[model samples]
Target: MTPEEKLQHLPDKPGVYLFRDTAGEIIYVGKAVSLKNRVRSYYQSGSRLSPKVRALMNRAADFEYIVTDNEVEALILESNLIKEHRPRYNIYLKDDKSYPYLRVTLGEDFPRVHVTRRVVKDGSRYFGPYTSAGAVHETLDLLRRLFPFRTCKQKLAEGVMSARHRPCLNFHIGRCLAPCSGQVGREEYRAMIREICLFLEGRQDDLVKELTRRMNEAADKLEFERAARLRDQLQAVRQVLENQKVLSTSKEDRDVVALAQNHDLSLVMIFFVRGGKLIGRDQFLVLGAENTPEEVLTAFVKQYYVRADFIPGEILLAEMDPQERPAIEEWLSGIRGARVRLVVPRRGEKKQLVDLAAKNALLALQEVEQEQKSRGQGRDACAELARELGLENIPYRIECFDISNTQGEESVASMVVFEEGRPAPGQYRRFKIRTVSGPNDFASLKEVLTRRFTRAREERELIQTGQLSTRQAKFYQLPNLVIVDGGKGQLSAVRKVMKELGFAHIPAFGLAKEEELLFAEGRSEPIRLPRDSRALHLLQHLRDEAHRFAVTYHRQLRTRRNLKSLLDEIEGIGPVRRRALLKAFPSLEEMARATVEELAAVPGMNRAAALAVYRFLRG
Candidate 1:
């Protein structure tokens, strides 16, 4: 149906609306109280829409929507859809890195704790959508030193533990309780888990007090060793607590968010406060941000919290639309499982904290702007190369492909992207060669290009038809230039696929490694640039990056295959035992050097099985 017809029949209920371009790609996503009124307003000539919205509407040939039960549901669905689709018109977060979270495997019999970038709902309790991975590591290290929890991925069932004759190295080092070997009781292990939870929650005072009480009880019962352990833990906890800054007198857990924006860029700073102390801060850079401060903050809050493991008791925003405050508060409260206030403090310490965050945001934006200016030279080189090659558009987005294999074994291809002369690592992709049997570079190149572009074409069609709302289709938008790591033969192979796939307009070239010669699509003679030429350096950078990425993936696959083969050669080492051994010792060298007792400590491995594997390796 036409957009007009769809708007006319739109429901008055709360829902999310999608505006699709003529190509059927969703260019915009929006949530509204009344779908009919919200959608129809866009088409009304008298409505004063923003420039961004006007441009979006002009290209929007069709639209679709999903009806939600209420505004809260609609708000939630909108955030999710926006994250999924990443529509051009939405103010979305675009950082290349994902924040890390502390994951507690609560579903396991003897729970394990670790840091992870991905959060899945499997009865796991995750904490701290920490800004930097380094911070997460530091926190995990501190926790490990204080509380000796098991870090293995082993099954801790009674049957598996009964088969183990001894604990692992971690248990000997006093860094784990050896729950896999039935060395620690479930109640004792669970009590340690409770302490960990309390410590992570920043209830340091309560944790310390509980530890002290337990220490006193142990001493009264003449358990000097247990009492000494508790005393050491209490001291470590106190040391960590001393490092935290007491920012608020009210002892309220809160998050202070602020942003600084230019016409094209925005920097958001979030300060995490727990138990009246400032724990840490994170900053994010958002590209293509032309929205108002209120709109940006609103979008940031929704996107940020959806992935956040913990929600603060109060969220203090630098700016937010008054109408959106209640809806955001309701949505956050539901996710947090408690009442969460969305506040815009206008006075006193709260306001001061927000101001401090804003100041940090501004400083971060300035640094990023300066860095971009320095990288402008690389972008200029791309523009120069475009003129030299007589291309229709400057190669702002360039994708390079390389193939790696060791004698046709573990063949793989890597595609690396450069945007505005800087590497966009998030867009980097790896493909395992499937169709081509051996190390046929030409055929392998053709197969990889076909798969890449075919999917891109399919995604483009789906987006234009409004059939697909979200896509991580890196190839959906064709790169302005393609570089393959080889001579004219590889270039010809890739070009043939591009032509067949109707992507011939994308200029492709091959950079021969030895001579550093560039072979264009139709040119016979190689074009040689000066050794110090910026364009040559840029091309070389891209080619080298692609080669590096492909080799890295190739090595990873080879290592896994080698490990599997080695394990298969050992007697009584089935898939389960093989997996456990690999999980315990990732490298073959590590496994080969492991003692029988160490190998036996792996869950599901009995002494006999461990001895067999150990003897096979030693032999």
Candidate 2:
């Protein structure tokens, strides 16, 4: 149906609505309590809409929606769809990093605990979304000391554990109970798991009490060894609790949030409080947040809590609209499976906490602004380089290329990007030389340039015709400048390829490593800048980074090839066994030093296979 017709038939219930462009690409996603009235408001001619909405409507050709059971479900589904599609007109969280979590494999016969960055629906209990990896490591270390649980990746089923005759190094070091070898009973392991869960949940008082009770019970039974062990654990828990600062008298879990915005950039700080104590805080930088503080807070609340493992009972915000408070609370309560309150404290300790968070946010914003100013020096350097080279456009986005090879074996090329004078590692790319043969750097460079530009032109056309989304075609856009690693020879090679590909207008240059001189196309002599010039230093940094990236990739390929060759030489070692050996041991040196029993413990490896690999590596 047409846009107007779909609006006419809209349902009057809570749901998520999607606006699609002519190519059927979703450009906007929104949640509404009353879909009929909410969707109709966008089309009413007399009503005023924001400029962003007007722009979205101008490109919107069709619309679709999904009916949810309630407003909470609609809010959840809207967040998921927006994150998945990353619609252009939505307030997207641009950071791509995932926080670490402590995962407990409760489904296994012998459960194991470890740190992971992903959350899957696999019957596991996750304890955290910790912002600092170091903090997670420290916690894991403390847990290992307090509880002797197994840390290996062995499939410790009842049948598998019964077959193991020897324990690993962890057993000798007293760090693991060696469940893989049946050294620990299921009930004993489960008790330890309970204690670990309590510790991670920040219930130190309960954990200490349980440990003390167990210690006394062991003492009553005349089990001195067990009593001593429990006593040590209890002491550790008490010590950690002593270090934590209690912020409130009531044992309530809550989070305080504050935001600071300067122009289009915003910084948000959230302090996590559990058991009435402040545990940790996390800061996020939001770009393109062109809205009121209340609106920004609303968007952040809806988006942030979806990935959180634990939702607090109360969320203290610096500012929020009264109309949106109830809806946000409902959504949070649905996710948490309990009642949640969204509060804007006017006075009290909670208000003081919010103010402290606001101060932190403002300080963080200042640091970001200072960093941007430092980056401005890089931009100025780029402009200076443009003036020196007599180019039309300033080189805000520069791409450098380098090729690495050793006698034509495992040849590879690297592409490094610099945006606004900072290295954009996410945009870096590597290519394995396919068409070139036998150490011909020039031909390898040519092949890489041709493939890169050809794809760029095709993606540009697709974007202009509205056949491809801008998000998908981001890496295909042309750079403002191109730098090659060698002198005049590499510059000429790149220029020929660009001319053949109908991109002659793109400025090209080369930097020679020996003399640190720049070579531009059609220039008779190389240009040399002063030793202290920022423009020359920027070019050198780019060239060195490209070279380093290319060398790293070349070494990885060479090492893998060498490993495969050595494995192929051993008798009775097929592909599966080869893969298992590689997975168990990272390098040839490690494999050579591994014991037969250790090698045999790996999956798909038998005693005979282990002996063969050990003998081959030793020989």
Highest lDDT: which candidate? 1
Error at 453, model 1, angstroms: 24
TM-score attained by model 2: 0.65
> Which regions of candidate 1 are displaced past 4 Å?
1-12, 95-99, 158-169, 287-289, 370-619
Residue-level lDDT of model 2, residues 255-350, one tens digit each, is: 999999998788888988888887778777765536678877877888888777778899999998777678778878888999999999999988
Error of 1 at 320 (Å): 0.7
Question: How far in Å is the alpha carbon of 294 misplaced in model 2?
Answer: 1.6
Residue pairs whose backbone atoms clash in candidate 2: none
- Note each model's CA RMSD in angstroms: 9.0, 8.9
lDDT (0 to 1) per candidate = 0.86, 0.85
What's the lDDT of the predicted structure labeled candidate 1?
Answer: 0.86
- Which candidate's TM-score is highest? 2
Evaluated at residue 62, the lDDT of candidate 1 is 88
Clashes of each: 6, 0
**Candidate 2 lowest-lDDT run of ten:** 90-99
- List the candidates' TM-scores in order: 0.64, 0.65
Could you tell me how far off, in angstroms, the CA of residue 427 lies in candidate 2 after the best superposition?
A: 12
